[model samples]
Target: MANSLLKHPDFMRLWSAQIGSAFGSRITRTVLPIIAILLIDADPNEIAILSALSFAPGLIVAFFAGGFIDRNQKRPLLIVTDLVRAALIFSIPLAAFFGSITMMQLYIVAALVGAATALFQIADNAYLPRLVEKDQLVEANSKLESTDAVAEAAGPGIAGLLVSLVTAPVAMMVDGFTYLWSALMLTRIKKQEPEKQARDENDNLLSDAIAGLKACTNHPVVGPILAAETLLAFFGGTYLTLYMIVGLRTIGLDPFTLGVIISLGGVGGFLGAMAAAPMAQKLGLRTTLLITLALGQLSNFFIPLAAAMPEFGAAFLALQQIAGDIFMTIFVIQALSLRQRVMDENLLARANATFQLTTGIAVTISALLAGPLTIIFGIAPVLWGAAIGSMLALPIMWLAKEEKAA
Candidate 1:
């Protein structure tokens, strides 16, 4: 149904940039925690605050970001953000070289990078539709998601290895350079955009944003599924907030072993990404969506349950990660594909921003709540709470009705 992207030069340029950026993002995500726990000796709450700070910018910027992105050329924004992120991340290693690395500096970097990431995401999503034809959106999105899966598969392990060979802060330099790589790739893409609509000077502040929110919420399939994703984001944020502590402190996984266990998720994700198109064809997209959600949600139960049974050890935890990663891979690709297929290109950025707004808030709330809740009820109880929240939202998906991969 879609044109092959094999010969599409612009799409290839974008894809190559994505591959670099995805891996860089993952490496930074992996190494930052190591730097926090090992270098800065961050407590559970400190880590929580760090995460909240990184994700918080989305809450602040996502609301109006779509309107901003939709009104501009995407590639320039992408290039600028990539360059800024590269500079911000490089500060970690430079500070370490001067023996001045501090938690505050890391916080600044996270916040700045998060802001850049928010802008880049909105621009990137909006740009994709313009680069490819309507029917090719799936193939494009699928390839992109697959790149993310590949990044996930290799990122942590690579980070772990890099951290072991070099210092954790030095490992961050790898990510910093990759962003520059992404920017270079972006410069080579030659696509041009259609003119932006002329905005009235009297345009309401949130007219476009409100319209996007209304459209997403009113769509039966998009509405319910997006809600599920928001809830899952909450659960995911909480799970991650506790994952470092749980794995490093309680279950006792060294960084390398932890990285390996996490990498298994990437392996699962790779397979899941490979399966999306074929599975969508064999079993309707709706069925595939529902099934993957069920599996992903079910995987959440295992993490908290593993805490109760230490005898099962890291193997159970690995199982949890593998399930969560694979199902989430499929879910993400399909969801993006569905949204791109159904929504008008003009409104895509706003709709994405609207989705980002709720999900970003969910993550922020989870990060803010996770530390204190763990202090009170402990990690296991809070994790179980996350699982329950995800489960409660699952029934909402029943309201979503559609057929086919699109």
Candidate 2:
């Protein structure tokens, strides 16, 4: 039976914090690349590099972050990271106001914000188990995902208006304030977290990091999920690296249209979150996961097709967004719930970290290659290749039938 988290005040606060952050984050995601493409006139190479910087910090620091999170208090880490992200994001608008903005400054901010995001993600994942009962993981995650979907649905439209009324750089002010709001909500949570486990005198950060990797790899259930996620990340990264560029520059989508299309995906995401538990209950976890993962990859075919046909681009993109987000959101919620359910609490942070590190490496590599690949093969062919490559994960999922063998 699903435990009711409605009476849990701390969980509510966390949920509240997340709602603001998710909305603000969607705004930032919408404006950041638009700022680069429109205001900075960044080329494909620069855009690829920017995307790479966003994922590289997770690749570089995730192992250590996982270990550190395992040994320390997550609440403080979450608070600090929020504050840092707020400050870093605020810099963009500040620079814009001073007429000192440059690609180099944007690059620096992306790298720093990415680092803070990596830490915040690891800490937040680890902190959740402490906030609610194990049985409530799905419900808790579902609520969070739903909030994200709503933000996803509305944030871009709002961002589009902001970008139209003000400039993209100035529009980032909303994200900064949202982060501040998230931090304040986090501070009000009065739940006492579990005491940190005693660290061995001989155990260092590296060793702890290694142990976390071992925990994931050694676990029968988590090992395959990790492998599948890493593979998907590479293809997903390649396609996403060019998505905005193609939408705005190549396909000639206006900011408002682009935002509306992206928001449609959030609507699908909300539906997916609501449907996940029921689907799992009906079709079984293994079946639901395999089907959703495959469908998500297959949905990408629309993206390249949309790019190829400019007149029908919006319709194709919208179909892909709604269908793709539904399946992917279902896959993500189930996968995360499974991980939280099976992993030992002491190693959960590290395991989550290990997943992030590996996937981050894959995404970073694919993103770095996207620009060069586009130059060599053109964006359409490269996008089609990414979509096909993502299907390679299906076999991995099929083989991971140890969850229930149903």
Candidate 3:
């Protein structure tokens, strides 16, 4: 199975581009906030706003973007979005070099880049069905997710080094280059995407978007997955903010150490993605998802404990990250494969957009809450709370009867 998946051309091309892009995203993820907090001297609230802005566009634009993507080809959208992102990222360094960088400007740029990212993702998900045979969907997704895991592991460490040597704004230039590389690779892919026919002149955009949402809400599998994913996103986002504070300020770990720990988690993610197909084959998708979801939730509790106990804290934290990454990769692959298998081709973009919207909203809410929650409950309590909230998703999954299908 692995050998055949590796040999697939479309999968290879998509995987290569995704790996490059994921690395670039991780670089920005590490350096961007650091630049805001350390260089620009932004406050915690401002940082929260920055994070929220980055994700908010996705929540707002996903439905419209989905409709547009459905009316167009995926490959071109991917290429255009990549190119636009590359340009936007390049502007960051340029502004910094000229002594014109500001927090507001950075916020705007992050929002724009995020919106473009949403468009790219909607198209990319829609494009996958055209790339490989139906049976290969799970395996192909696993390979792509594994590449993402590798990038997640390596990108932050590389970003830390670059920032240490060249400064944060300068480090962003590397991410810009990565986007360009991704765009170049995308340009080389020869697949012909099916174009959407023109709609009636009287067609209503709002109605179409609403119809898409209804389809997702009404679907048996997609609805539950979205609910679980939204809950996961909300908790995960809060955890991320708290984790950073605990790792950096409370524990006295430097950025490099944090990067290494994150990378270690990536190793687990890669292993998880690689193992996903076999696990699905053995346990079946529903059982695999249930097991992984539970594991992911349980691992969250360990993070706060690790923060409290400095002795062996890093190791415990690393283990938590690895476990979380593994579960995330498995869940993502399974969810995506099921969506592709079940949804109509024409509704693919819209359905995916609906999912993206929920995730974005959850992330935005979590980002907004992270600051106050940490202040009130402290980082440890917040992490523990997130773990508890995550576990609640299990009952939803169980009640949905996802395993019956498998």
Cα lDDT for residue 145, candidate 2: 92
TM-score of each: 0.89, 0.87, 0.89
Task: Using lDDT, give the best candidate's number.
Answer: 2
| lDDT, residue 321, candidate 1 | 81
Looking at model 2, which ten-residue stretch has the lowest summed lDDT?
397-406
Better of 2 and 3 by lDDT: 2
- Candidate 3 TM-score, C-alpha based: 0.89
**Local distance difference test values of all predictions, in order:** 0.83, 0.85, 0.81
How do the residues 1-406 of candidate 3 rate in per-residue lDDT, one tens digit apiece?
5569677676677888887788887887678788888768999889878877777787767867777777777888888888888888888889888888889888988898888887888888888888777778887788878888888777778888899999888888888988888887888877777767587566566865776788787887777887888898898888766777778777778987987887788898898888888888888878888898888788888788877786767777888888888887787888788888788878888888888887877876896798998888777778788888888888777755453221
* Top-down lDDT ranking: 2, 1, 3
The alpha-carbon deviation from the true structure for residue 305 of candidate 1, after best TM-score superposition, in angstroms, is 2.2
